[model samples]
Target: MSLLEVRGVTKEFVTRGEGAMARKSVFTAVDKVSFEVALGETLSIVGESGSGKSTTARIAARLLDPIGGSVVFDGQDVTRARGKDLARFRNNVQVVFQDPFSSLNPRYTVERIVTAPLTYQGITPKGGRQAYAQELMERVGLNPDHCRRYPAQFSGGQAQRIGIARALAVNPKLVICDEAVSALDVSIQAQVLELLMRLQRESGFSYVFIAHDLAVVRQISQRVAVMNRGRIVELGTRDQVFGAPRDEYTKTLLAAVPRINPEWDAKRRQKEAT
Candidate 1:
């Protein structure tokens, strides 16, 4: 069985205009999207800004409720998990938001931020929370001595490392990276991606990576799901989706990626001809 499965998940938002004359309309953010992520794998959902890829990630993370369908993780239906069950489910799943600056609290020190999950779940680490948090910071490429520093003191990349460290503190089975590196500089983004891949190799954690960048998705994900208008237009292995996209939307998205080498098309053509 897959580690995580999202079956026919749907989400809608009701918007109502204020004042004397107002109209209510239901906006479908996600429509019957289904996919699965296996253990120690990365499943990336890529699309444009309003394509609902992030919404699907939110539902899978249990940060938002799905209006329809169910999310199953490790054979348990967690769509409506309650009380201790819900808390346990949350412990096994974690999220790293897009923006590090806003996702982390400016007032809290790095140690406190990384150990917050353990504190909330009432889990005391083997040695101590402070030591554990410092170890996590070092694992993510941050200075262990910087544990006493706040979010504002770190660079964007360093702040993101802190966020990643916090996500892994609970030793979650799955981590939802919602545009986790999109906000960083290109160089920094590559570093973060490498860090995530290395960490995954060591910890055996799966990722539901949500992003608008196709190139970034190609680098991190084993499987790719292309979303359009709140629906999945294509789903397949990275090679299958990138080399021979079956959906028109997927093709369009691939074509939009900027090429650093001007002869990239010629090289592709030559390689395909052979």
Candidate 2:
């Protein structure tokens, strides 16, 4: 069975008109979107901004409730799970936000920041929460000794590492990376991607990777879903979608990527052949 199933999920937002003269209107942000993420797989949702990819991620994480459709996790319906059930669901699923700087609390030390999930879930680690936090920091490539340092003390890449550590603190089955590497430098992005892939290999956790970057998506995703205007226009394996895109929007998105120089491409091809 799939680890996570989002069947015909939909979300809407209601906006009030400016002042008393304004009227209220409803806007559908996600329309009957459906996808599945298997255990230990990376399922990426790629789309331009405002395409509802983030909204879909939120719903999958159960951070937001969908007005329509159902979310099933490990064979349990979680669209309306409550109390202990909801809490357990949260522990099983975690999210790493796009902006690492804003996602972390500036006031808390790295130890506290990473251990917050454990604290909220009322879980005490085998040795100690701080010890577990340090272990996670090390696992994510951050210095375990720096656990006492605050968010302001780290660079963008380090801060993102902290966020990843936090998301993995509870040993979640699924991790929703909502543009988790977008804010870092290209080199840092590569490092973070490597770290995530390594962790996944070691931990066997699934990932719902949401991003607009097709190149990045191709790097980490086993399957890809392309969203446009609040719906998935194309869904397939990375090779199938990138090699032979069926949707026009998907083709346009692929074409939008900066083309490599002929000299560089030729060199790359020659190197591969050799």
Candidate 3:
């Protein structure tokens, strides 16, 4: 069974009324989008800005309710889940935001930041929170001794590692990465992505990775879904999307990639010559 299913979801925002300027138009941010993610797999939602990629992630994470359609998790209808059920749903699906600096608490120590999720979930690990937090730190490539250090003391990569550690604190079954590594340097991004993959393998967690960079998504995702103007235009395996694009938009996007790769350059030159 699929781990998550977003069935024909639509999200619309209504313009607010103002003095002598009342407006009632609906801005369709997301339109009739549907997809599924299986357990222990990574599915990437790829799109440029304003393509509703983040909106889809928000819906899956239960941060926003869709105007039309349902969100199901692990065969349960989470679209209408309430109270403890809603809380449980939220706990099971965690998010790692785009900017680690903005996401992490400025004053809290790494220990507190990572352990906060466990405490908030009312989940006491086999050992104490401190022990769990330390283990998490070590797992994410941060020194356990640095748990007491504040976010200000950590670099961007380290801060993001802390964010990953915090997200794992609740033992989430699925993680929604909303451009989680977009702001990091290339090397740091690679390191963090590797860490995320490692953690997922060890913990058997699923991922809905949302990003604009197709190259980065190709590195970690088994399948890719392309969203354009509030709808998914194409969905396929990484090789299918990158190598055998079936949609014109997908082909155009692929054509725009820099011809720095030798094989790609040779193929393009051949095409041009022909």
For every model in order, what is the number of clashing pairs?
0, 0, 0
Q: Candidate 1: list runs displaced more than 4 Å.
A: 260-274
Give the per-residue lDDT of model 1 (tens digit) for 1-274.
9999999999999999897789898999999999999999999999999999999999998989998999999999999998998999999999999999999999999999999999989999998978898899889988899999999999999999999999999999999999999999999999999999999989999999999998899778889999999999999998899889999989888899976464864674475458
In candidate 1 the C-alpha lDDT for residue 157 amounts to 92
Best by lDDT: 2
lDDT of 3 by residue, 1-274 (tens): 9999999999998876777877687778899999999999999999889999999999988899998999999999999788889989978898999899899989888888998877777877888877888999999999998888999898999999999889988888999999999999999998999899889989998999999887788778889999989999999998799889998888877777654476864684475457
Evaluate candidate 2 by giving its C-alpha RMSD to the native, one decimal: 2.8
Supply the global lDDT for candidate 3. Answer: 0.89
- Please give the lDDT score at residue 138 for candidate 1: 88
* Ten-residue stretch with the least lDDT total in model 1: 260-269
How does candidate 2 fare on TM-score? 0.94
Off by over 4 Å in 3: 16-24, 259-274
**Per-residue lDDT of candidate 2, residues 154-220 (tens digit):** 9999999999999999999999999999988999999999999989989999999999988789778
